[model samples]
Target: MEYTLDMAVLAILIAFCVNIVLCPVFIPFLTKIKFGQNIREDGPNSHLKKAGTPTMGGIIIIISFIISSFFFLQDNFEAKLVVFSTLGFGLIGFLDDYIKVVQKRNLGLRAYQKIILQFAVSIAMIYFIVQYGDYEKMHIPFTDKMLDLGGLYIPFLLFIIIGTANAVNLTDGLDGLASGVTALVSTFFIFVSWAVGSGTLPVAGAATGSLLGFLLFNAHPAKVFMGDTGSLALGGFVVSMAIILKLPLFLPIIGLIYVVEVLSVIIQVGYFKATKGKRFFRMAPIHHHFELKGMEETRIVTLFYVITAILCLVGYLGTAGIF
Candidate 1:
């Protein structure tokens, strides 16, 4: 256990050092390539000035994880699968970002197109886990019970991979919001992995370190945006990590902020259509509602960070004795 923790820590330091060194040179290069994010016209008015910031920063993040995986998780088959699935999702996000930025269009890949790609990736990942990885049962949180999904696990896994990948995407609105929350969630994954001596520790550590480094420039009054590339990659990696640990059922509890963000958008959209455009929150994503209610972006981000920490604690407690 101690050795695994030490290894996780080493992976984190390596990822952070690599990412920090890459950011300064990377941001300028992105600017030169004109790979700037297109701010949605309908978004918060205060974000107007942030238009054209360098986006697609997920490239560096994925690079860091690739490097981290080779160094710290080379022998772990499950970890490799998680890392590769994340890379696959990163590619999808990269295509989406490319269309939006390079193509100079607000709408990137059409929604169905992205979903189809996501489903393809999800199915591939689920097949790998079921065929290669040993765990086929989910550990019920807060109980000494297991539920075998049998063949149904395929669809269940698909729902989780797609839902969580997009859920984190929706939470990317405010500066540092997605990165900070993801960093915290990744940190929780490290603890959980450590508690069980799981092979997932290295990738989780890599994720934590990369997101923390990204947040240096992504915080309030940001200089760059993560775009879909970062968010979806994050969503992919996070959900994969949870599934790799066989804790997919606990993902919503561990990542409640993401759940709320997605739910808020769904509810807002459904209600708007039902009521013929009568609104609930000032915006779809819940974070935007607080923003419209006069909460500073930094404050909203900070509060979400705190909430994520507490939820992770609950999740950790619930699963502590399972291993």
Candidate 2:
């Protein structure tokens, strides 16, 4: 069957409805099972009250998107690759969240263990892309140029997968922050994928719709958190679709918020050590810095949303060779 705009729209609506219906059932069940959030004591003071809000809400997005997207994956190998890549990373995240919330392990997966798992998943994705796809050349944004990695494609793609996934994870600090920002980014992907006649449109559409539905509960004064489960899976979903669409380079433009979030942490860490315990921002991730600087969480999140939308337009222009 030929894919159309209507099919994409239907996919979005299906995922949205599924997620909307699932949240009420999932949140209370999580609460009953004591799968609550643990606010970092070193973080913002206001967030302490968010403690005990049900966590691991990413499962809702995963289930919703997969169910809605399954129809479009009938014979599309690329779409299957994107969807399963998302599920793979989501399983890793689920494991982490399970360790922390269920087993009461405050640190969740150890640093080395998490890295090993992420590496394994990323490698698996690269192997599939190499064996089954033409993903060697990356489009340079705002130009009609393709940079082929050739022998280095494996490492380059690996970095894109791991870096983007973790960058998105860092952006999950505030309620509605990661989910809202990612929803906008995925919507941009839907448009671009449609413009290019890419098969990944359904995955992007499902992501956009599922995240928007998730926002109803994730917005400021959130009823629950997506935790690492949602954030990492979102990262995986975002990067995988980009890779499949051959638009990986557009990430820094469309995902600028995630880049900044990761940079803030890096700058904060590097500066703190260099200054002999002095700090750069009042906090890392920059969102918490603004929170410390007296910005309301809702306002900051809204600002990020608007910025992401604008960046998406810029990304579209670049992708279309209009800029």
Candidate 3:
């Protein structure tokens, strides 16, 4: 079955429509259920105003993707794999969000617990890919060379999934930061998936469309926060797509902002420990540093969006052999 651009556009439109229509209904329901966000006391003062916003709004995007995917994707192995993996990772995020919402605490899953769960889920996903698919060969973007990892593919796959999932989580410090960036990354993934002639492109396209729709409600002064639910799930979904397409290396290019966000935290922590509280930035995650430096939140987010868009174009060009 040949995938066409028209189908992709249609899928995106459906997802966008679904999300815009559903967000209003879901946001109010979440607030009614007392699932409001808990702001960190140490966070930027501007975030205090967002404290009571509805949380777990990722449920809206998840539901919209599932419904839209079912309607838009054709019956194919790759499509099924993408859909199932997305929901499976989303379930893990949902569990974490549930704990936070029920306990009314900012702390959800402990670090060790989250890591263990991520490992378990990532391993399962890799095993499924290896057993049911032919992805033993890895491809490097902008080149036709392939690296056959054979038995070592497991470890490599683990790194891609875990790294991407955490990078996105780290980038979620600011309002709409993760959602907007994720939508951009997913849009690139759709292009790459199509260029690679993969049957899963339609599903990726639909996911991108769904995210764009979600972003309308998820941007600054957001009516709802995606929390761990959206960030982790989106990270997992995009990473899995790259893995299935054998293009994991392109993630660093497509998700450059997320990488910067994660690296800022890592550097800050390392420096603080080495110097007994010395710091590289006013705050970690880089975004907060800009806020501390007196940059408006809206400006910082928009700048990041522009950077994300540029990187996404570079990724597509690299994948298309135009770079």
Candidate 4:
């Protein structure tokens, strides 16, 4: 309750430790349950080998976050809200992942189905945020002033919650990309939350620690993939931190990688439709375009990390004065 060291470093360590231990045990169990990933044949040929790697590893991050953040839970209401929202999205993702497992193939929930579920959660997130959120103003980048959105904040908040969740989901195509970038983004959120004296610090800590730990297996030649489950829930967690800090506007700058990932797909598809079957890139998500150009998976992932780190730094510096 006093913002002790355990609430900071120890919580991270605990989360990291938990994931490191649980992953090996969990991966085998998922395999036993036939919960393997199905690679898309139309995608990179190099990714075919990734097929059947145990999927749905998000449970590990969720469990690890809960265990580590539990220490500070009683004192932090906002942190509790984050945990709940994460679990809600996790369930939606789990259902999607489970459908893929049942079909023994890559195809899972239909796009409409997933969007409906996500929108349901987004609406709920907005209701809670509007009811209990601490501030009416958001810090505008490169300005010393905070912008007041008033009731308009509700619709804007809905876009952030739903859009960001799906954006991160699309970014999950590469191993270590989503989790690794999320770790960096969460690290920034943790600091930014502290800067604002937010009650959401514990959830931020959990996010940072669990994703770092998840990278132990989620890295190159990943032993396990977090699937839609981790990406969506993580997206929710990250944006929720912004809501609690009233920094939702800064999220696009901080979460620039997610923006790019989703945009690449939209651009690729929209162009193909307009051109009657031409591509703007060799593949969508941009990472795959790099992959098709012969860039190694690890290299592409690392590059993304660097870019995300730079954008996060920019977002931090820009918002520093207003906060």
Candidate 5:
């Protein structure tokens, strides 16, 4: 089926408008419900004032996307699958967030517990795609050739799901960071989804619309944080698209910022352990380092967005053979 540019634009506009209307209305409600973020003591001093900000605002985006999907995507199998996978991951994140909020602790679920749950959800998603989705071959970006993973596909799928989810989670340290980057990433996926001509393109389109909508309130001095709830769900949704469309390999290119953030944290921690407290940057995560280097928050975010847009364009051109 052909997807018109008009439909894509309309979906994005609708989702954006809905999010703008809902964030203000819902943020206060979230606070009243005691869904506040538990700020870590070790975080940047500037974030102390943001301690009581409402969290799990991702629920608003999730609900909006689900509703929008129903209204805009009818009988689209790929869209339905993407929605299901997103909700599944979101449910796990919601539980983790609930634990943090209820316990009034900065840490939520135990590491093993979170890993086990994420593994279960990812494995299930992989199985479903392998059994029900089209295209058994994985396409390498910028090339027409595809790789058939055969029995090894599950491991690769698991890696993509868990990696993307954690990458976004790690990137969520600052206000509006995760939401802004996610919106940009989703915008690219919308194009990829459409270009691939997979049945799930509408789902990607709907998700893109919803994320853009969420970003209106999710930008700087965020009234409500997307929390683990939104980041995990969005990450899962993106990975699901890659899996369904066999574009998992493209994540490192399109989501370069997230990749860099996750890598910085890993390198910093590892280096510190090896050197008995030697530091890698002013702070972990490349963005926070830039902040510490005296870059303005808006400028840093804009720069990251610009880089993401460029990488996204590369991914598109690579996939569409425009290079």
Candidate 6:
């Protein structure tokens, strides 16, 4: 499994093309199945018009990634781990989407149920990473040193995997928001992974391409929503790449959008409880707050993209040991 730069770019291009092809076919099929999105009643009023749009388009992304990265799959632990984590989380998301669309449950999986499944996958991944991962040293940003967490590695990894997965899930509220942000993050990962000679480059490249292709229909006035299916799978893919590349520490920098999106919810909830029903932002997840404040959805999304790109640049510099 010798990798070349051409192969990496090819993987991305193949995934992008495959996704472009699949979306047309899959979106129609999803619509035929009546797998439409159930917009939150409490969400922005503008989203009500998207009610019947096909959801669960993440299947397209997963299929494209698997197909594009297939030729680059190595017969080794890293490759297997990446695939396993992605599919495992994707399965969880698929089930959630199924319950929502088919069963007509607005809340697909119970919070407990979702957490249980996520924990199961996270624990399994952490176990395999400990036993088979090539390195136990986590990189410390802006320095030439690596830190060994030693005994705390398992819990730390669990926190990262689950937190990242859910953070991405939270960021999926708006059309193309999650997919767009993730594409940029995945692009960052591709370069970082390649720099480290990691086996995860193909997967990262495929992710970037698939997300971009998905954006064709996922952007403003989305023809289809990715639902939980795509969001959780993307979270899994992102965290796994970071873990394998020993760049989990760089996630808060590179994935600043995910971190802030999650934190906004946390802060809003805590503030509301403490203030006895007083609100913090106009909405949680911050993006919604901007929308509530009269910013256009496209504008907010672009702002996030710009911030994420800058943060990714910072991460790249840190990874290159440029302080």
Best by lDDT: 2
In candidate 6 the C-alpha lDDT for residue 301 amounts to: 89
lDDT agreement with native, every candidate? 0.87, 0.90, 0.82, 0.85, 0.79, 0.89
lDDT of 4: 0.85
Query: Please, what are the lDDT tens digits per residue for candidate 4 over residues 1-323?
Result: 45543466777888999999999899999999888888887899999998889999999999999898888788577888888788888888888888888775456788898889988888887777778766668878888888888878778887888888888888998989999999998888777777766767767887888999999899988999998888888888887777777787787788888999999999999999999999999999889999999999999999999999999899889876866
- What pairs collide in candidate 6? none
What is the lDDT, from 0 to 100, of the residue 274 in candidate 1? 95
What value does the lDDT take at residue 65 in candidate 2? 88
- Which tens-of-lDDT digit does each residue in 1-323 have in candidate 5? 67655566666766667777888889889889888777767656667888878999889889877766675567676777788888988988888898889776567888999999999888888777778777568778899878888887777778878999889878887767887787777777777666656666566666777777777777787778888888889888878887777787788998999899989999999989999989898788878788778887788888888898899889887786421
lDDT of 2 by residue, 54-77 (tens): 999999989998998998998887
Q: Candidate 5 at 128: error in angstroms?
A: 0.7
lDDT of 6 by residue, 1-323 (tens): 55556767998999999999999999999999899998778888987898999999999999999998887885756767887888899999999999989998888999999999999999999889888776678889989899898888888898999999999989998888999999999999888777777788788888888999999999998999998899999999989988998888999999999999999999999999999999899898899999888999999988998999999998988886622
RMSD of 4: 1.5
TM-score (C-alpha, index-matched) for candidate 1: 0.97
Q: What range of 10 consecutive residues in model 1 has the weakest lDDT sum?
A: 1-10
Ranking by lDDT: 2, 6, 1, 4, 3, 5
Which of the two, 5 or 6, has more lDDT?
6
| lDDT by residue (tens digit), candidate 1, 294-318 | 8888899999999999999999887
Better of 4 and 6 by TM-score: 6
Candidate 6 Cα lDDT to native: 0.89
Q: Whose lDDT is higher: candidate 1's or candidate 5's?
A: 1
lDDT (C-alpha) at residue 163 in model 6: 97
Residue 71 error, candidate 4, Å:
1.8
**Clashes per candidate (backbone, < 3 Å):** 0, 0, 0, 0, 1, 0
